[model samples]
Target chain A: MNKINILDKVKSNVTNFFQPKGVFDKNFVKKPLIMYLIFGLLLLAIPFLQEQGYIQFYTMGVFGMIIIYTIVALGLNLLLGYSGLISLGTAGFIGFGAYGLPFFSNLLGLNFTGALIVTLLLSALIGALIGLFSLKVEGVYLAIATLFVGEIFLEIFRNVEWFTNGFSGVKFHYPHVILLFFQLRITVTSFILLVLSALIVIALGYIGFKKYKNKQKSKIEKKENRITKIKSRLLSIFKIALIILGLMLVLQIVLGEPLLTFVQSGNSITTTGFRGYLKLEEFDRNQTFRFISLILIASMFIIYNIVNSRTGRALMAMSRSEHAAQSMGISLMKYRLVAFITATVFATLAGTLYVSWFTSAYPDSWTLGFSLILIAVVVVGGYKSIFGMFLGALIIHGIPTFYLKEAFADINGLPFIFTGVLIIVVILFYPYGAIYLRHDIKRLYRYLKSKIIKFIHLIKQRIQKSNDSEVNEDE
Target chain B: MNKNTILEVKNLSMYFGGLKAVDDLSFEVFEKEIVGLIGPNGAGKTTVFNCITQFYKEDKGEIWFKNKDDEEINLNDIKVTKVINHGLVRTFQNIELVPDLSIIDNILIGAHNQFKSGILEHILTLPRARREEKELREKAHHVLEFLKLHYIKDMYVAGQPYGVLKKIEIARALMANPKMIILDEPAAGLNDVETDELAGLIRHIRDEFDITVILVEHDMGFVMDVCDRICAISFGKFLAMDTAEEIIKNKAVQEAYLGGDDFE
Candidate 1:
């Protein structure tokens, strides 16, 4: 009896651990939780292993890139998916920020800390202006207007020598902190720890979502209510755990010191007389990459809230039919402005990130051709889902360059060509992107399961009736 | 009628490239009164509603709307957004609930102006903004209850029955908390039972809320049973304006109906 009681208590506690609250109430389950936990542990081991020379340094770099792209993808999802504003100039916004942030850092000597703030504010201002103008023209015409903005910015970056460091590009130095009295030295291990901490900070966001879904499910008697509540809870907790695990795996790689082993590879031109590759001595001080990632995460959360708010609903109504929205006492122009402004804010922050990471501003980076890639990420990920964009970024930008670099290394621009092809496939086969695909697939599975259950219930009812009739005959 | 006058129109006119849609139309709607605007197709009944809502720019018109605070606003001077702010909102002939959004979400959108917290507040989700959001949701639920649409509150607007969609639209319009609601056609596509329910609902809306109601309906029975006064129009011109009994006896209105019946 004691053993049975202990087992029951353990089972209940385990179930409770997976239960989601608030928004995540609908999806808590066992399978998803296990998958996320395993995945997160694997990832968290990466950097430390790289440091110990067990994993490649490029893998960690790829992870960083994925984080950044995920942020951009989330932003685009709000503009295109939730609010129905199609923008093709996403890359331009991100690239502008990326290039702009680094350039500001170089010229002002404010280091990454000050430059990050300045870069975000400037991007927001520029984004607001662009949004204002785009609202005047809509549909294909608005796309053209944004296209022109990207093209114009690219031209300026290329031609303007002083602002963009010309075609050859500019270089930047990182900042260092030392104890005032003790003169204690700061190390690269500490920097990697900071990055790891950021990943954990980001993963905690799943907790918030889980809580929200659970709260909603508790209020309604929807048919799929209980199942959905379980699923949401499980998904969020699983995602969080998986993220932690993934970071730990990455840390293991970093501990092996993968970047330090680059000298052993065929790229030993550094020994002869080449400086193309980044030196570890200076790269450690540069926090632009991390700051960019942080900004992307912040902006995405804000955009998501705006898309679900009253203003977002009004924008969608306006998008459907201007005449009807007007009848409902919604000002069409006001709603249009809201969509434009929201999208532009995302674009500007993305641009600043680009400037900061590359330590240079280049016109070609913000071209329409480049910006279309960002749009493709949103499309491939699922335009309406922020989570989908994160997945899309991983598929389009992360995997191709990181895992498959060797296959296409000899071919010029093959990665981009592959991304373009993927975009086409996603648009045709999965118009909503990867996130919607997952949602639809899950919904279908649930529907099938419920049908089976109902059919079984009917059979049982018939059997019970027959048995009752037999009992009556015997009597 | 002096104290009763809530919305007064003088020589209201609207033209689309010399084709006068509303030609020198004039009318008055009183506080807490249910007024019906009935006419044949293209008789400019909808155009008057459009003009009042400022959906279309009028060629000429003077509209004075008296508020609860006893301030009279020149409706012509007020922009479309301000129309709602001034406590005047309208529904469409076709249900105009945001189709992709949930029924509850549609109602919340109608209450956009009521929640004055800006983008920053919403993004940060400040205490006051959250409080306002909670209150707004409660108000939306109340509106749904008033219209008997609370059951389908969580359902998406797509594929709903016409009568239900129509009620949902009314619920959404009420979210604006307007002093008066202009329903373009309350019972156009409803069955007998639904129409009866709609009539009861409209009366509840007026009596319980003490709000002015302007209905543009073709169903004469519904209009006669519910309206405090009736206005009949023909060829963008007003033929009769009086009590339901007076409208029924008016020779001008009878002739106008006869004239349109042959065309139909």
Candidate 2:
């Protein structure tokens, strides 16, 4: 009973961790909690892992790329998974952002936020145009039409050098409007742990004081226990002092940057953080990666909420049976347009963020192959699942770009072949995507557990029988 | 009895290239009445249903339905989606609930138009969005309870018993707060016991929901047992409109069904 209670408490806390209370709805965080925790821990520990030489430093840049693609895939899933519409023009829409941002900010003299807004609007307009031409047709036609749209954008990128700068590529520089990144001598893991404990301590202190004030105060008043009162006051002061100390340490770590002087003069203090030497540029790149990870979480939060709402239901219904959805008052034209625009906007947003990290846009990057790969990412992850898209992006892009590239450096184009084969096999076996791997793993574990229990029972019985025989022999 | 015309169909006609599916048909349904549209296989019964619901654009016709706001509006003038705004909703000949969605989620979809929150607000999960979602969820639960299918609320609509799927469709229609609902082949694949249970369920919907019911079904026994009136059409032409007993006795309806009244 006590164990069950502890488990229940843990489950509730995990669920409440993403509740976004006062901001999000009560049940907004009804996602796979274990996946969230795993991702959360990985993201926080990644910088530290690299700093500690457990991971390659360049992997940060690769993770950023995977995150950008994942955002785009999540948007596409809204179209493909729920609405049953396919848009192969994801790369083209994203190019508009990469090119449009530079054009707006540099050439058009717009602020960064203004440029982003303009980019979103421009993408939406093009998205609507493509949707208008193709959406009237049935399923396969939409795919063919969007493929053409993608080709058209590529041509525009090549010819319209005035906007995209053609094969030369367009450069962008973001001044970091969010103010999120900071370099510290302290490892990220230790810093995060400190912050978490500090928060828990403060929360506990507040709760205990509230309880004492409400119930214990009256008891103390009746007893007239001056000693108890003074002790309680002293405890409150101590709590306040502890909070101040935690804050001071946090400030020192973030700002002052003197953590037992493990800097090693110029060594990265740890080797895996940079290539041979520590540079501010490398730190910025790592921060960009971290910033994009924050973006991944936000996008997931938004998509998860929307996918569980009325609009999502309508889209799913429309995909399954148009006549039923129509009779139920879900407008096909409205919802289809919404899905198309939403998908393109997300692609564009990913592109803009891509520019922030890469600081440049190349026409070669947003080609037909990239668009196909984006589709593969969404499918291989999970079609209608938000969490699956992230996992999909990681496996589809992260593995090939980070690990496979090194593992098969001797063979040219080997990683691409590996990715293609993996996608085919995964789709063949798990048509629902690799997200259902959890279910399979859980089943396997349970089977093993039961078998182990049975084996133990048999062994116990054998030992008991031997003991009985030995006792009879002694008699 | 005061006959309140909740829906009035006038000179409704539809065509399929050269084939006249529904040549010209007319019917009227009173509020809180259970009406059945029945005929032979090629009698254009479903075509008339499609026309009234605006699933197919009629060559010529007027479909005036009394909305929840107590206003008679022409469904022909209204778009297909806006027909539900006038508190007019429908089911399909085959069960059309989304297979992947849970039974309760499938039903909550009928309340799509009831959602006033914007997509952005929903994405953010704002308080208004939360409030609206909570309200609609409660409504869905209440509807599930009414149909006594609350136990299977979390189960997927796919692989459900045929009888349960049929009830789920009706339950979804109820979630719309509709003034009138049209069910197509509500008893298409039910056993005798299920058919009997469906009749009771239909009666309960009519009495409890205080809405008119119009269904296209070939289950004559179920229709005759439940419907307040029966409208018979043969080859896109109206044959008869009366109570079940009168419709059965009418020679035209019998001729339309049994082919020149040659009874065994």
Candidate 3:
């Protein structure tokens, strides 16, 4: 009885210590904005830590690759997850961006931004062309069509000497910021600060919007005087102004010095015609890591918001039942085009980032196997989830390239073997991917918690009975 | 050209190779009326619905619908997706709700055409898109409440009971705010009690929403209990069209149901 009592006391103390604070506890973590902020800070700090010798450069590079692939996976998720359209031609679109970036920058004498825009537009056009052909086919046929398209792109890249530099590939300088007559290099610290600040601003905007929505809901319930209405409106305006001011302050902190230096150092405003006053400058490994991380974070938020909106619902409906979606007046062609274009654009963006990081575009880099791996990422990550895609990318791309490659140095094909095994396991047990693991874990915890509580109750009852017997014996 | 007629199907015909699925069939449905298209299995009832909705291109037909704006639009020429824009929507025989989605989300998909915002607005979650979403959500909730499905609004459609799925299909059709709703075999797999409940719900929906209903059902009792008028067909050929009482008394309909053994 004494042992049981002691055990019960210990358990109660542990439970009390872990009890939620009702607000800003487990519930706060449940909020996506908080999770984004936490992840954003961690991603921003990793590269800096690596440069300071706290982490390896190779590990940082792998992290950078993971960020790049996450953006691609998110874009693919918009297609495969919501729209239910499978494209094995993701690598082809990536190639378009990779090659297009350097081709425009080096040959056409366009700046980085111009090259990026042109590449994105070109990818969209190609995606639409593919989507047009896809309209006539579905399921396995569509998959096969995309596979061939991917091969065709590879062939073009390998054979086109004048445009893609043939199999030799095209090498170019990294992207840079050129203002007026002077070039401004974005240092690693400033880049990290910029990304972290942007993420913070987005998180702040999301929280502010949520608070405003809640306030409006409460105000709707209460009848207000004219003065109160005016006061509330003024308060909302002030809040908006405050958010804008916060954004400007963060931006200034990151880019203020660079802009000041460029302005003071430059007097010549040369006419560059179509290319503008921008130039491409070489960036070190850490700077590239920061840039890719920034792009990944921004893309994650955008894709997350889109998937939660009305457009997402329609796309999902179309994916589930084309007949029903059509009955609801969701134009199959329009939504399909939208999905294809968005996905291709995202792949192109990732490719552009990749070329900027590596300072080279190679036809052999993007292969059929690479495209299949991307699809695997979406499948193992959990369909229709932005964060799941990130997790999937880490597990599939990050773990293999960084962790497993080092751990299993003798095994030449260990990553491929691991990916195949993981895919099979995910398909068999958790077909919904790693995201569904969260639900299963929660259910398990609930079951265990109930059992523990029941056991505690039984122990308490037994102890009470022993006490009663002892009292009776004494009497 | 009748002012009361909401849908006028003129010489509709659909064929597959040598087989005539719908053989020059014509029918008229009036405004705010419950009409039933009754036939035996494989009697081309669903084909007619498909042709009217332009899911299958009719080899020859003219389906003119008087929209909410009182404009007579030819549905045959318009695309399948545009059919709902004229205030005409349909439910499937197999219950085509998005299986993985919550009941409310499935209904919101039904309100897709009603959204005024474009892709940009939806992606950005702009004010217009947010307002439209809230309005549609409230509308979906109201429809669920009316159908007494408010409790299961958050539940996914997968593995749901047949009766609930049928009701959800009706609820989805209602979300379009249609002037007319076409239900294909709504009571196909439902029990007697559920069929009776469906009959009552159909009447309630028609009365409350002030909309017309056209159901293709095999259950004779359900058809008699709910429909004001009945159109009977057999072997892709029209048999009879009259009030429910007259349809029950018609010899041709009885022959179509009892004597039709050639249907495949």
Candidate 4:
């Protein structure tokens, strides 16, 4: 009984000392904000690491690409991971952002801000339209429809010089900015975008208003006048804002007045005004990597917040069982559209970031192959994990391009073979994703810790035995 | 029983291809009543539950329900998700809780409709979202506490024992603050002791929440023990709607269960 008590006391002390919770045990790597910050910090440090001769300079560029794609994958996680909606039109819409920006800012003389706005609007509109068309079909059929959409975008990018500048690609120089805040370049082009967004938002608002109207009008038949009074005022104010926005857009396009573009530097490398003061001398890949790193981190924060909230629960519920979700008052159609559109929006933003780095848009880059690699990233990373998505991006994207190619420099075909085999092995072993490797890692850690403790106990016993013999010799 | 009808299913029918799963079935449930829907295996009891919950689309007839808002609305007109908005919630027969989520998180799903925060608010974890989350979390905890499930709230629904899983499903339905709850086989996999406790628990829930319950079960003793009224059906046709004693004494119910006096 005394021996057992001693052992129990020792065990309790050991457990108390090693307990991780509240001491980073709540989870260090799994903690949301810290993980994103670390991701951004590591990405930022890559350029410095390159300068220190630890990594190659080309690594900065690849890391930049990873950052951009990480942004896209984060959004795709919502659709693929949360709602379980498989969409293949990602490359198409991202290309839209990449091409749309240059098309508007370079060809049409819009500033950076205007170009981004137009690009975002165009991507959202097209995505929603496609979501509306394709989302009616469920499961693999939805994937097939989106596949068609992707192929169609690729064909359009190949054929239409107006959008993608054809095979030669669209090239334009982006002005160097201190923080994107200081020299926030505003650019032009694409009335269809501004009009489309205004129309869609107004249409949605109107529909909601009418639905509310019907509900209230039905609920309290006698209080019709009050309902009309409150609803009309809100709708009227909303419509007035829309009208004003419409008029301003018309003036900016038709009259050619610099209404919004504070810069108004029409396709000129040199700026002359307050905008000139905001411009930095140059922007290399290193700086771009850091900037895009911050961008990726910010998006990760947003996605994390979204995935932990009520909306996220609804999405998971829908993904797991549509019947239960529907019975719980989760409208499948609305959340699906939201997930799809949010995905496309993020893809477009990533495209915008990609163009910001490369200063060019190429049809060759935004292909079906790139889209599949994205899916592979989410799959390998663990669909439900945000941090795992980042790791997945690095592994899937970095292996084939950087490490594998470099290691097997002489063997031209080996990298592809190795990457394929590695992916298969990882998937086979960790069916959920590489993120699940943590479980095994923790188990190994515990086993090793116990082994070390046992060794210590043996050593202590040996020392005690030696002391006892020395005491006997002295006696 | 409350004199006012809470749910009126008039001539409800559902068909799958050429099969008439429910052919012109009708029933009524009153307020604050523990009602049992008993039928022989494949008598369309589950089909009726599905149709009432709007999980299955009906081919014919009207399902009028007095919602939590005290508004009598047709269940057919609204979306499936909207049924819960009207304060009607149901538990699945097969325990449909997402295994990935914790017990508390699973329960929060039923409160999905009560959340009024916008998408942006949710994405940002703004004050409104935070407030709603805190409030609902407390509510879920309260639900867990009521069901004696608080100790295991953090555990994932996966790998939980069958009895615990059933209790968790019930807790999830209760999170909606439902005016009416439809339970599909609440005692299917449960042992006798659990079933007996479940009978008391059901009565307690009806009394405490002041809500009506409609459960589909095959356990005749359980139904007889628990139900205020037992509605029997055979081949999608209404057999009898009466108290347990009357249902037991009824000849049609006897014939339906035991293959009539000829078998004897």
Candidate 1 per-residue C-alpha lDDT over B1-264 given as tens digits, one digit per residue, 9 for 90 to 100: 267799998888888887888888898988999999988888999999989888877788798898657789888887877788788889888776678788999888788777778876677555557668767876787788777787888999998999988988788778887899999998999999999999998999898888899999988889999999998888788788999988887888887877634322
DockQ (model 2, Cα):
0.42
Off by over 4 Å in 4: A1-30, A51-54, A174-282, A463-475, B1-3, B262-264
In the range A380-454, model 3's lDDT, one tens digit per residue, is 999978789888988788777876777888979987698678768877888888888888899999999999999
The clash numbers for all candidates, in the given order, read 103, 0, 0, 12
Once fitted onto the true fold, the runs of candidate 1 whose alpha carbons sit more than 4 angstroms away are: A1-55, A173-293, A324-335, A358-361, A402-421, A440-475, B260-264
Instruction: Please state the CAPRI-style docking class of candidate 4.
Output: acceptable
Question: CA lDDT of A464 in candidate 3?
Answer: 100
Candidate 3 at A219: error in angstroms? 8.3
> What is the Cα-based lDDT of residue A370 in candidate 1?
62
lDDT of 4 by residue, A1-475 (tens): 5445444444443333323332355465656687678767777788889889998777777877877878899989998988888888889878888888878877667666567777888888877876687546888898888888889988999999777879998886653442322343433544666788877776676665556546653544334445445544665577566667656655544444434433335455443442223323566667667777877888888888888888888889988988888888888878877788889999999998888888888887877888888999889989888877877888788778988898999989899999899999999998888998889999999999999999999999999999999999999
Better lDDT candidate (1, 4):
4
Which tens-of-lDDT digit does each residue in B122-179 have in candidate 4? 7656556777986798789889989999998999989998999999989989999899
Q: TM-score per candidate, in order?
A: 0.74, 0.83, 0.83, 0.82
Give Cα-based local distance difference scores for all models. 0.70, 0.81, 0.81, 0.81
For model 2, the local distance difference test gives: 0.81
Candidate 3 lDDT over B92-204, as tens digits, reads 98878778889899888888888898876655555667668767887798889889998889998898999999999888889888999999999999999999999999999
CAPRI accuracy category, model 3: medium
In candidate 3, stretches whose alpha carbon ends up further than 4 angstroms from where it belongs are: A1-25, A177-284, A443-475, B260-264
Top model by TM-score, which number? 2
